[model samples]
Each structure stands twice: as structure tokens, then as C-alpha cells.
Target: MAETIDDKIKNYRTAPFDARFPNVNQTRNCYQNYLDFHRCNKALAAKDQDVSPCEWYHRVYKSLCPISWVQKWDEQIENGSFAGKI
Candidate 1:
């Protein structure tokens, strides 16, 4: 296992196997990572902390989610119509 968060980030190639998302469908995994990316960024930014760690979630979601879906969700987030709380 990685010794630190930086190692985890550096080692990332695709979404790692998650016990919470064991099924074949990765839709939930993708969506959760998408939300996690935004939440991590927002929370860390508020504390004046580096937000680079959020990139892990961004990479994971980008790998698993459809581009069209990401676009739509991004648009909805901008328009305040996104259903998922970020």
C-alpha cells in the first residue's frame, strides 16, 4: 500500500477497487468520485490548503464517467440544478 497520500496520488492510473462499489456497474463509483472531487476542493480551499489531492477523484471519475454525463452535470452545477450535493 502507498505510504502516504502523495504516493496514492502518484500511483493512480485508474479508479482503484473499492469495497463500497464491488458490483460491475461503476456509475455510482463515478458519481461518488465526482462529488468527492468537488467537495474535497471546496473544503480544502476554504482552509487555504492545497487542493491537488482532489485531482485523484477527478482522474478516477474522468476514467469511469461518460464525457457527456460529466458535461451535463457540470452545466447543471453551474446552473444550480444539480441534484447531487457537492
Candidate 2:
């Protein structure tokens, strides 16, 4: 059987050490997580499915990105001005 999105969510662990972001620069990871959170929410909402799984990305970005950056993004999202791909 194929793995469902729910199964993936149920099996979620912390984000592993990404080879792409070695050393003290987790910028890519943070940005990716931010994009993923929005994408997950949009996808699940469209399908009327559980959005809980999207929380992983939320947690990751929350831990890795600056609060101000998140706040700015939130504002941009609300105002339809965010530039980054969702």
C-alpha cells in the first residue's frame, strides 16, 4: 500500500540535519519550511482535509526563523503582498 499524507504526518520527526544547510546557516531550511507551511495549508484546505499535518512546517519555521521575519510574512500574506512562492 502507498503511504498516505496522514501516515507521513503521523510518522513525522524533527527535521533532520540537511546537507544543504551545513554550518550556522540554516537560512534555506527556514525559508523552505515557511513555504511548506503555506503550501500545506493551501493544499489541505482545498481538499477539505485535516490541516494538522501542516503544523510540522509551522513548528520548524517558528523555531528557525526570526519572529520579526515571520510577523512580516504574516502581514504580507494578509495583505496579498508576499513575494515568495507559497
| Best prediction by lDDT | 1
Per-residue lDDT of 78 in model 1: 95
Q: 1-86, model 2: which lDDT tens digit per residue?
A: 79986676567565667777787888889988999999999999999999998887887788789999999999999999999987
RMSD of each: 1.5, 3.8
**How well does candidate 2 score on lDDT at residue 46?**
97
* Poorly placed runs, candidate 2 (over 4 Å): 1-15
Our tally of clashes for model 1 stands at 0
* Native-to-model Cα distance after best TM-score fit, residue 81 in candidate 2, in Å: 1.0
Best by TM-score: 1
Per-candidate clashes come to 0, 0
The models' CA-based lDDT, in order, is 0.93, 0.86
- How would you encode candidate 1's per-residue C-alpha lDDT over 5-84 as one tens digit per residue? 88877877988899999999999999999999999999999999999988999999999999999999999999999999
Kindly report which residue stretches of model 1 are placed more than 4 angstroms away from their true locations once superposed. Answer: 1-3
Worst ten-residue run, lDDT, model 2?
8-17
What is residue 40's positional error in candidate 2, in angstroms? 0.4
